[model samples]
Target: MAMFVHLTAAANTPRIRRAGIRADSRGQGGVRGVYCFPVLPSYTLTHQWLRELARFGPKGALSAVHVRLDDAQEVLVGHYRDRAKDAQQWLTAAEAVARVAAQPDPRGWEVVVPRAIGTREVHRIRAVPQVAGWRYLPGAHGTRPCTCFGCRIRGEYGGRRLRERHPHPLDGPPPPVPVLLARIEAAGDPGDPAALRDALHWFGLRRRGPVDRLARLAAHPDPTVRRELVWAVQGWSTPGVAELLDALAEDPHPDVREAVADVRTL
Candidate 1:
């Protein structure tokens, strides 16, 4: 037999003890299963998913259900992202344990049994420390975050604060033109490519702005900055924009000229 541990809300202990662990959908393609980690010699490895699972349960209180399955019982085992039917490999319960145990770091690996665990298969349920494992991803602590809109969930804990602090490039409202211009001006001599790109992005968003102050960026040494200028000036009703586009249309860089052609078509 192969030993595995299933983590769940502490509140579910009574029902689980009565009916055993019911199989649930793994959140994609109606494929139902019970997710577990093979009970390895290392306690931390056996319960590595506890902290991440706690986010979906009642606060951080969770119980570990120890289960015993026949070594030949077929199960799916792979990284969490490979849960799709075609991506995961079917391995026996014992093989799954060996695969995960051999890994130097298996934080995101999982085992999914296709059917409910019988009451006889469940050995015991015990409370575990709320802080037993990594969250977000293994070794994610101390890493800089990617605050793009697609990476953030609206109502998730601290999501609102994070979005406000680091607004998405394309989702949030653009800052006023004067603020962007000030940022460019504060960038000094050759100027910050990031600040210039930020200002240009706002032009793409607003599509219409005073171009007199921005006309100088067309001559910026960076072809990317000039290409962004081509994108920024498209569809603007402001004066001198036509002349600016005409100049960008003949830019030395083929990419900048291509951007100008693209803008003209739009």
Candidate 2:
């Protein structure tokens, strides 16, 4: 999911042999992707788009820049040290290439198929973000997956839950308890750390009455259930919780105890 690619120690004085979004014509069933040739010596090209373009699959346009190596020599030497091959490498860099080179038709969008238009900045374009926060968002240094599948699922849960179920906002109440919980639980395993965290976080906000009955297992005897109970209870802002926290705050296990203490604070 991370595409901060081809920046080699040699890249300090990187000798950009060749870089661009391209379609390769070599294979029987060529794939398209963004490619960089003769990458910083010893540094392998792993960005999937490059390989995809090299095979001429659905690839973007070629837009890359070049540089001459100077102080970067030492950096390249060090980067490839781990690899068995220790040698010099380089590739070609071309400029002002085609973009299929044209403007697009707006009204014909759904009916007409499309080809990519190359941009001078094409090389810098990001992959289509598959999941929220899975991108190297602007202003961030290193890229990390900011959202897990569970988190995305939870957001979807929240969206559907908050939507108007009937013709008017007050036409009917929100979804029933069993229906709503089952929908959330269907998003993924409750045992998943992210899923559990989302479940506990959301239910606290809805605050459905007959609360314990609606969230039955939320107060079950099992330690896992107890942990979730503590997660939700700590967020309860109203009255009568001091007694509950008191019994839980000094519980046997550390995690449960911590959860109890957290609930007390809430």
- Model 2: lowest-lDDT 10 consecutive positions: 105-114
**Tens-digit lDDT string for candidate 2 (1-266):** 11123211222122233333233222111223322222222222222223322222233332223222222221121111123343312211211011111213111000000111133323343233212111122223364323332322223333343343322222223346565466456655334454454455545544432344324444334456557656655545545445555666666767788777665564
Q: Number of backbone collisions per candidate, in order?
A: 0, 20
Weakest ten-residue segment in model 1 by summed lDDT? 146-155
Identify the candidate with maximal TM-score.
Answer: 1
> What's the lDDT of the predicted structure labeled candidate 1?
0.83
lDDT of each: 0.83, 0.34
**In candidate 2, which residue ranges exceed 4 Å CA deviation?**
1-175, 178-202, 211-221, 237-240
Give a tens-digit lDDT track for model 1, residues 1-266: 99999999899999999999999746334558999999988898789899888656566479999999999999988888775566777899999999999988888898889999989999999998888888778888887556664555445788657756877768544687888778889977578887788778777756579889888888889899999988887878888999999998888999999998887886
Top candidate on lDDT is: 1
